[model samples]
Target chain A: MHWQLEIVFFIVLITTAFIALDVKNLLVAVVTLSVFSFISALLYIVMGAVDVGFTEAVVGGGVSGILFIVLIFKTSRRSSD
Target chain B: MTRKDNNPIVSLLSRIVSPFIMLFALYVIFHGHYSPGGGFQGGTMLAAAVLLIRLAAGREISQLQFKKSWGTPVGSVGVFIYFFTGFLALLMGGNYLDYSFLPLGLEAPVTRGWGILSIEIGVGLAVMGILVAIYDDLLEGEPND
Candidate 1:
């Protein structure tokens, strides 16, 4: 395990998580969340859990992104809080 | 969502890419036993392919690809396939989901492999159908304007 690579991934993961939570626009938040998911999937792969990484990449990054976008369109674009 | 505007480029690009995604999804499902990827991941990919079209084109146009009404039934059939496999093993005097007595006329190991394959297929289908169904249901009540 390359600790350096892992550290870099962790940094990005934390950054994206913060961005996702802090963003006011729900669409940007959703997209950032997708990026966060993809990065975590990468971290999973780095840790040698290939199957879990594959699942995270597919469901978290792809399908959930679309679902969240649909939810935004159906409900509201901006978060009230 | 209804067609808000026409963008041939988006529609055409998605049309071009969706089939390849589906093909890869099938590959993932079939090779699940030997690979890191499996039924759920592959099934989600399939749903993604279908949803790509639905998002690019409008709902009415995309219905030609996958009817909204067919989702729940397809999911049910997939579940039946899964349960029937297990129950067939049970009825054959083996424990539930025991593949040795599956009557495939193959060696024990080979029959076990076949059993797992069928289970994966069922899971893949069920996941794909249910996901698409969720997407459809989520958008069903939206007003067309």
Candidate 2:
């Protein structure tokens, strides 16, 4: 694996994680969280764990995103704090 | 989402794509032993496909595709399948989940392969059903604003 690509992914992963946390809009946060998950899955594949990457991509990015969106719809979309 | 908010394009496209996602999920499940994907990943993919339709087509329409009431029963059946496989092996003079002792009338290696496949199928079904069930329950429990 190329170190350059790994570095790029790591940067994006960290960026998304922070954005997901810092965002005030719950929907945006959830979308960013999904991005974070997909980036991490890419990192896992780059690190040679294909199976782990696949699971992360499917569960973290897809299922969890839907669940979070449903949650946002159920409650308030804007954060109180 | 409400019917008033439905977009025809999104509905059509999701309906078209969901089937292919399901097809790929099945492929991943069956080829799991030879590939990077297995039961859980495949099952999640399957649920994603179903959820896609649910999201695009609204709740009432999607019910015809997969009823919310079916989710728990499907999950229960999947668990039963997994348990029965293991128990059958135990009853046939082998350790629990020992495939060679299964009454498949095949060679040990082949029987083991079949056993693993069956296990994978069980796991896939269980994961798919439970995930969808969770989604359904969450939506059903949502408070009206």
Candidate 3:
């Protein structure tokens, strides 16, 4: 059971990172990154670093993505810089 | 959206979803001590809530804005807060991030807990602010954005 959970989690984690990388739209990418963070947070729980996981979830999954989206709206999506 | 003004779908979804998001973030942050989360996770979640507000309300109406103009300063201050608080611990003759030597009521469990919590809060602030700033900076030079 534990092994199955780990397998599922690993798959989720990998997929999350790829979603962040694969998404073309900047906003989507940012959102994917947040999802990635959440997966990491869950991974942390599995690894017995509950505190670290929590931090990762909130900061990485929650705030960072919002910041990205806001910036996307304020700035252009073009990659000049 | 501008057209979503009378849209029950958008309003209803946001009403139900947003509060849950915010609450979950808080829960993750608050329960961090005993569980799989902490200031960073919690703080980001908190910031996410703000971001959600920004998204739904439109940039014109800021629910909890730090402002693009002040992005750099706000983020920097958040980082400085985290470091400065840690520096305080160092000033009391402990190693960097050495919570045991924090001057918070003198080294007992209560003091130690207090010290750690303070540091976490500072880190949370920094993480939220800096991430927001970076996002703004990245999107700043885009055209037709």
Candidate 4:
């Protein structure tokens, strides 16, 4: 119910998304993506779904990070596009 | 002798900090039920520690250092652990996730707490694995560090 926390979370979420988008380096973008995930998880906590939010942070931010890194290793690091 | 004996903080603290990080991670995992923190949070924290090692020790630290394969497995494994606990409860003939259903002990709240704890551990492993996986993948993708 605390409005300030909600505002802060929103700002963080937006910033994360922007960072993920703006960063040229794929790795930097990926790290930004994690930041986004963490912010959303915080939102979930505010919404009273602490457990669900926790899961999201873990999976979206954590495991997904690992997957991205692996895929990067398998593929080319340079953005040919 | 020179390289190994670099800055005082980074040198002496290096050995101490990593273990402490690891221990704190475990502590967070076990204390999830009674605390505000839980599996995912703890897991990410754990991964951060590894990332720190990677940053400080450079890539050559460990050959078996959770490169990639660990990611997907950890994710699914966490879910598996969660469901498995529920299944065990179901087999015992109590409603899904019903603590009394488990044969371990009939203590109401404790049984439930235990279930959540197991799930948290799984979640911690999964989340931590994923964070590193993502970082490695993303960084690896970049042209250069």
- Point to the candidate with the largest DockQ: 2
Model 2 pairs whose backbones collide: none
RMSD of each: 1.7, 2.0, 5.3, 6.3
Model 1 DockQ, alpha carbons vs. true complex? 0.84
Error of 4 at B10 (Å): 4.9
Q: Which stretches of candidate 2 lie over 4 Å from their true place?
A: A77-81, B141-145
Candidate 1 TM-score, C-alpha based? 0.96
Per-candidate DockQ vs. reference = 0.84, 0.84, 0.48, 0.14
> Model 1, A11-81: lDDT tens per residue?
99999999999988899999999999999999999999999999999999999999999998888445487
- Measured with DockQ on alpha carbons, how good is candidate 3? 0.48
What local lDDT does model 2 show for residue B54? 89
How much lDDT does candidate 4 score? 0.73
Give the C-alpha miss distance for residue A59 in model 3, angstroms: 6.2
Candidates in descending DockQ order: 2, 1, 3, 4
Between 2 and 4, whose lDDT is larger?
2
lDDT of 1 by residue, B101-129 (tens): 89899999999999988988898999999
In the range B39-121, model 3's lDDT, one tens digit per residue, is 77766765665556545554445424447566556557767777877788799898887777777676467676776676667
Ranking by lDDT: 1, 2, 4, 3
lDDT tens string, model 2, B19-122?
Answer: 99999999999999889998889989999999999888988888989998988887788788889999999999999999899899999999998888888888
Per TM-score, the best of the predicted structures is 1
> For model 3, what is the alpha-carbon lDDT of residue A72?
65
Clash tally, candidates in order? 0, 0, 16, 13
**Model 1, backbone clash pairs (residues 3+ apart or across chains), number:** 0
Q: What do the candidate models score in CA lDDT, each in turn? A: 0.92, 0.89, 0.66, 0.73
